[model samples]
Target: MRQVLFLTKIFLKNLFRQPSIVFSSIILPLVVLWSTWWVTADLPMTFELANAEQDVSSSMIDVHVVTGSLTAMAITAGLFGFIITNEYRKISDRLELVGYSPTTTGFAIFLSLFVTLSFSIVITVFLANFLAAPKDPLGLTLAIVLVSLIYVSLGNLVAIIIPKATEGTLILLIVAFIDLMVLTNPMGGGVYLESWTYYLPGFWPIQVALEASFLGNASVSTMVYPLIYFVLTVILILFVRNARARSTMSFLSGGN
Candidate 1:
């Protein structure tokens, strides 16, 4: 635990040293939220959500926009994942060479990500409430947090696969824009969900957020999609880590 904490501290200090990273991971999301709120505040847009109990419908514009924007926040988390993994790959490798285990290095990476991502999510949710209070504040926050973590896992995979910050960041942005904005947001022509779009990455998390924000509760069926995706991402990350460790050992042993 001490070693994990030590590495985590180092990771965080290095991360914060890059002003661009701090801006993108922390400040950028807040800017998006404020921009979204400002744009949707007076667009005469009201999303009609079916009530859980009755067959009635309620029109919610502000909360809907806020929740939609919350999903976009995951893009920043993904960027952070990509940056941290690729940028610190050498540092983590050296630590393992000295005395740290792979597990310790991986845990430190996760811890640093958790610290930054959680802070971003919390502040974003708090600002969302300040803009337009949702019926279930905690539910909204949890939904966003889960979605962001899922993207963090994705970012890790992308870093491993691409290993290039510019390309990885661009891919993440394009994916988020298409999946979250163009396909999920009502203003972006997703007022009604098509069956096929459900297979997309951001669909379920956006559903969870919508349910919590307007319906006041997210159902189990709605929450299951993101959970499944999150599990799959974790498995992929573990597999990659194991492969890297084995490859390193093989090289050190000189093909023995």
Candidate 2:
């Protein structure tokens, strides 16, 4: 535990030294959130009730806008996964030469990325509430945390497999585009995802956030899915570390 904490601190110090990573991971999300709010501020909100008049309440409109904005925020948070991956790629060899175990080092890297992503999510939620004043403040807060965790986990998984920084960034861009343009598009029936879509890490958090923001009650199961993803991600990271360690030992023995 102490070793993990020490490694986490080292990771954070490394993060702080890189100004661009800090900006990308922390500042960029707020910029996107602000842009979203600006664009949606004037749009009319229309809702079709089951058996009543189509009411156009401003508050209802605001809820829809905020949910979309929060989705953007979640995407931004997920992008940090790529940043961490790139950082690891740059330092992996150095750390390995220094005798640090891959598992400890990779986990430390992830912890730093998680902290920055969490801060960005908080900023996004605060801006959303300040600008629009969500009806259920607690629900909105919880939803943001859940959504952030899901995207961060997804980002971590992506980082683990992709070797090149540019490739990781490109992949993240494609993912963000598909998630917003196709999966979460209200016009394309975002509410009714196929069974396979449910397996997507981004799906549950966005669903929970949308439900909490607009419907006032998000399902408990939807909220639990992201937490499950985080656990799985940790497991995968540990597996990668163990694999790398074994490979190193084999190479060393053969060379000797």
For each of the candidates, the C-alpha root-mean-square deviation to the true structure, in angstroms, is: 2.9, 4.0
- Where model 2 places Cα greater than 4 Å from the true spot, the runs are 41-64, 93-99, 187-192
Can you write out model 2's per-residue Cα lDDT over 103-142, one digit (the tens) per residue? 7777777777778676777777788777667666666777
Q: Point out where model 1 deviates above 4 Å.
A: 41-64, 190-192
lDDT of each: 0.75, 0.65
lDDT of 1 by residue, 161-189 (tens): 78878899999878877777777655565
Give the Cα-based TM-score of candidate 2 against the true structure. Answer: 0.82
Q: 42, model 1: CA deviation in Å?
A: 3.6
Backbone clashes, each candidate: 0, 0
Clashing pairs in 1: none
